[model samples]
Target: MPEATEDLARRGDRAFLAIGIAVALWLVATVIVLPIVMPDGPSQAVTDYLGALRDGDVDAAYDAAGAERHDADAYDTSFLRSEALSTDWRIQSVWTSDDLSPYDAKLTGGIEPEGHETQPGVRVVNAVISHGDATSRGQFYVQETGSRDFILNPFVYADAGATLGFVDLNGVTSPAHRADNGDKLTKKDSFALFPGFYRLYQHNDDLFRADPSTLMVLPGTDVDISTSLSLTDKGNKAAAKAVRAQLDTCEKSTQLAPSDCPFNPLDDGAADSVDAYDHEYRDVKDIKWKVLVAPKFDIEPRDGEGPGDFELVPRNYATIRLTAVGVDIYSDSDKAKRFSTVCPIDPEDLVLTVTASKSFTVSGPAHTYAGRACGRDH
Candidate 1:
């Protein structure tokens, strides 16, 4: 009887060992193998969309997000593949819930068509995403088509407005007339974009530049992005050189008042009119001028104008030495006398127009003497 009990006990031990092996195999299949063969769920859809953007695959991203594609000619879609797209991103967490009402207040804040109620068979997938130094939480509504397969709701996008008139997105020039979403963008126009990261800046490297401004678009949100352009080190040097070249050209002229130049011998405060100054110097001859001090410029954009339109204003007066041989009209002498005087020129406004071809033109109104200057030799 004791031997029989020992046999039964051994059988029981073997049975338990067999059942443990079965459970282990089942766990491995459910945890590892099932996901490989199954279709993507709501969370996977969001993952695919963000991955496509990082890879610069616009078509894949559009398909993943179910967003409509606009014509390339009509819309400025080059930003999709631009280098400005942020690749430093990671998914912190993804949570799925059938009750979307809890997320409504946060996700739909500042968005149009507000106050959305919960729907049946739709799951709200909330993801915490981070890029560089910024992190944001966004929600996407997805519904299962079949089994694990799911599709994101259509027209799920965000709006981005900018304060700048003309801007460059990811090195691609985006003019003020057209937007990235095929809309005619005016001063108040906004771009409808998918959830992603974008960079805004000015592309005029020779004359103007701005720090790269970043925009993070969260789903169902209206965000504003802005950046102020300032003269680059290269641009400042170029502007100074151009102004000096213009002054040199003016100094080479033999006329008392060089046309389109910033300097002249006429005393603006003393002379009543340009005509009167011309009459006073009608008999002047052998006129020569030299730039004593070249004017310095502060490069800035013209008010209410787009990029490539700049105004160069002198911060200080420019001095010029003038020498001429003219008759002494006040002395009633017909004999010509050598006259030498110094005049300070005021270049308050100089227009510098930059074209698309990267060529620039500098022009200014003819400037008269800023301070008192004696017409006779000093």
Candidate 2:
């Protein structure tokens, strides 16, 4: 009877061991193997979306997030696929709608979602994405199409506006247009962009420059980045050169009042009698003009204008000496005499327009005496 009891006890031990092994096998399959084979959850959807961006795979990122691509000709997408967007990024944590706060869940109200609707099986995934020293917390809506498969909704885009007419994204010239926010249109020129790190600048750095601004785009949030452009050192130098060249062209003219020239010998009252000078000085042989002091001026950007628009504001008057060999009509002498006169030119603001090829066109100031002749020597 004792030997029978020992056999039963051994059999019982073997049965317990077999049951323990079965449980261990089940746990392994449930914990590790099933996750690999089954469809991804909401957290994985968010992870994949961010991962695609970090890899500089813009198409993959947009596909993973189910976001529609804007018309390539209409929107600027060069920065989204450039190397500037490739940065070290990681996902800190992801939470579902139940774990989010009321304010967090409603973050999508500002930006219009692509095609997502609040319904059953729709889950909002909140993730914390970290890049370098910056951390962005964003929310994404995912809908369950299958039992375990979740499709991430579209992400948010940004509109970049500039005080200048146009703005550059990562050194590419992007033409700006009026932004349509689904309700109304904006007054400023806007460029549609994807969610990523962008460098806001101007490609025409020789004429103008802005402080390089770093724009971080987050999900479910619309960003408007505005930058102010000012003239650069090179621009000032170019303006000075243009002003001097214009003045030189004016000096070459033999007329006392050159067309479109800031300096003129005839004042407003005497301007009408200028035509009589040529008849009066018909006996005179040659007329010469010499600039005494060059005009002193400063360059400034035109207010409420494009990047290429500028003005040369005069700081001081320019003195010009006119010399001629003519009969002195005041003395009633027909004999030729050397006549000399000095006129101080009050230079007005000169409009400077720069072209895309960096060529400068300087338009002289408007004067009352333009095209009028200088009367006989006073």
Candidate 3:
């Protein structure tokens, strides 16, 4: 054999020897060193707790941490909401330290908030809790009786109470669940919810339903859900019907005064003469009405009781527009067939203040939105 060949073989043998040593070291570390140095118990406890939560065994998870201040009802409702709204959480990392308690470990996971499905990585504190018994101290995400859970704090900003109960699209009411230990009614705002998806309706059939609207309750913020209600399709329909009823009274009027009809555009002098021409507002088209229901009870400074009794009366504003197909101005007084040009009654838009509650009742004199009459007026 050549000396060069022998030298190459010796080098290869040394390399193999180095690789073997490295493997041996790794084995030693995996079998002995890791066990001795890394505190797996804490990490394991965290895993067990997370598993319990994932399985909806909240009590088990709390028991694992020896949690004393466990409000099962509140926690259960909140957890259920979280689970329903959120996607599967993936464990990012699990770290343990000897300097910390044997049960102390830090865990990280990725989660996405409800509506934001495309994005992820909302980190929560999944740390191995070092409270209560030494054996269970390794448990993760546990809280004392009075203490708030870190995970829950981020999800629910405030316990909101609605003056009027809200019904979902399915007609499910807001106070969805009530538990002995965790009655949602006892909470402020009647709901402990963070801003997310909700469909709400007023109890009054006359009022509109808010369908699949996002209830914007910011985390760590308080809001009255009722203050921001909008008109539903049903509401718009009702409003249009009511306006047509009012128009019917106007259509059949002859005197053009309050006795005959509450709404008279001629009274405002916008029209030269409604009685002179035959005004037929059949199939009231392009009808637009939006009702904004606001907080009504006036906090008046009256001396009777301590800050006065709450008058159920609330005030709301209604914006309305009505357009007619034709307003016939005739040579003869008879409305039957004088044969005048078909004049379009442009949209008469009016904002009326109404004394409103569950239903909007026009408070003062009725408002009439009428376009131009035939004559140019002297």
Candidate 4:
């Protein structure tokens, strides 16, 4: 009886040991073999692409993204040489469409994998990538080869409502997406841009009449970027009116040089300095303001601020072009005069803060023009 009991115990122990070994083998197969044989999906593809970008291998990243030949090189150069330089970029999440029945709907031509028609597997992956403090999320549409290879299709796109115009953000040009019928620009209201900084007004003489505003295109979201030309028109009209109003003093006053006028910055304390001074050499004549071009506001972000934070800034040397002529002067003697007869006045960098209803407040001395260039008639 004792021997039979011992035999039974030994057989039970062997059975338990065999079960343990089998379980261990199963775990090993699941951990190693399954992963080795399993095919990579869109999530893995996004991970790989982001990994390439993080490593500063922009060429590889662009190839993975299937970007256009023209823009691919430019983006790569921009990323490495100037923008988006970071090594710690990491993928946070990936989202995809799971329905396999209609996988080829989003694929574009040329970049599609060979034999994709036969295999016909495609997926759109939206991935969030972070580097340091900046994070960007984008969509990538990828296609599978009939065999084992995966290729990226260039049709991956984002719809951000409308495009107002292009802005120069931190010296880099980016498009501002806005709503249609803004009536501010001559183009349609659809545009796209990679995440970056932008200025309100671009460098275009034709667009000098445009109001300036700061713009910022952030990552991971779609939004409308629009500004009112009405505000610009209002501010410009008000400012121009204000400046012109000041010049009107010159027209009303019989003095050769009006004390309230801002057309000239230099106060040389000459014979014309005295208001209503009698001049036997020349009588105070007609004064008129001729606006060669209407005023436009170019703005920049305030110090320690982004596109949303802004202040009026001048870019080109000339904002308002005009000829301010003071007629009626005897130029026989070269006597030093505080004001000139028949002088032309031009101003640059006319700074003003635009408010609601097209109103604006000027900065600096109220009586002094921000930029003044006055010369004797030649």
Residue 201 of model 3 has an lDDT of: 45
Q: Among these predicted structures, which one has the highest lDDT? A: 2
Cα deviation of 188, candidate 3, in Å = 8.5
Write one digit per residue (lDDT tens) for candidate 4, span 1-378.
Answer: 699999999999999999999999999888986645432566566566566655666567556654544542312222122343345346666666564333343223224344434444665566676545655565555675444324354222223222223433233444443333333431232333333333443433222333334433322244344444433444445556655555444445444334434333223433322122222222223333443333343554233212222344433332212222232244555443333323233333233443322234443223332223343333
Model 1 C-alpha lDDT per residue in residues 68-139, reported as the tens digit of each score: 565222333434453546666666666666576444433433222223354455667776767776887767
Give stretches of model 1 more than 4 Å off: 1-43, 71-78, 82-86, 94-126, 138-166, 176-194, 199-209, 220-225, 229-232, 246-293, 298-313, 319-348, 351-378
lDDT per residue, candidate 3, 259-353, as tens digits? 22333434234333342234432212222221122222221111112111111222433121222332344324333332222222221221221
The TM-score obtained by model 2 is 0.53
Model 4 spans > 4 angstroms off: 1-43, 66-68, 71-83, 100-122, 131-137, 145-349, 352-378
Candidate lDDT (C-alpha), each: 0.57, 0.59, 0.34, 0.41
- Cα lDDT, model 1, residue 246: 71
Decoy 1 TM-score against native = 0.53
TM-score against truth, every candidate: 0.53, 0.53, 0.31, 0.38
Model 3 TM-score is: 0.31
Poorest stretch of ten by lDDT in candidate 4: 72-81
Query: Candidate 2: minimum summed lDDT over ten consecutive residues — where?
Result: 180-189
Query: Which 10 consecutive residues of model 3 have the lowest summed lDDT?
Result: 301-310
Looking at model 2, the pairs that clash are none
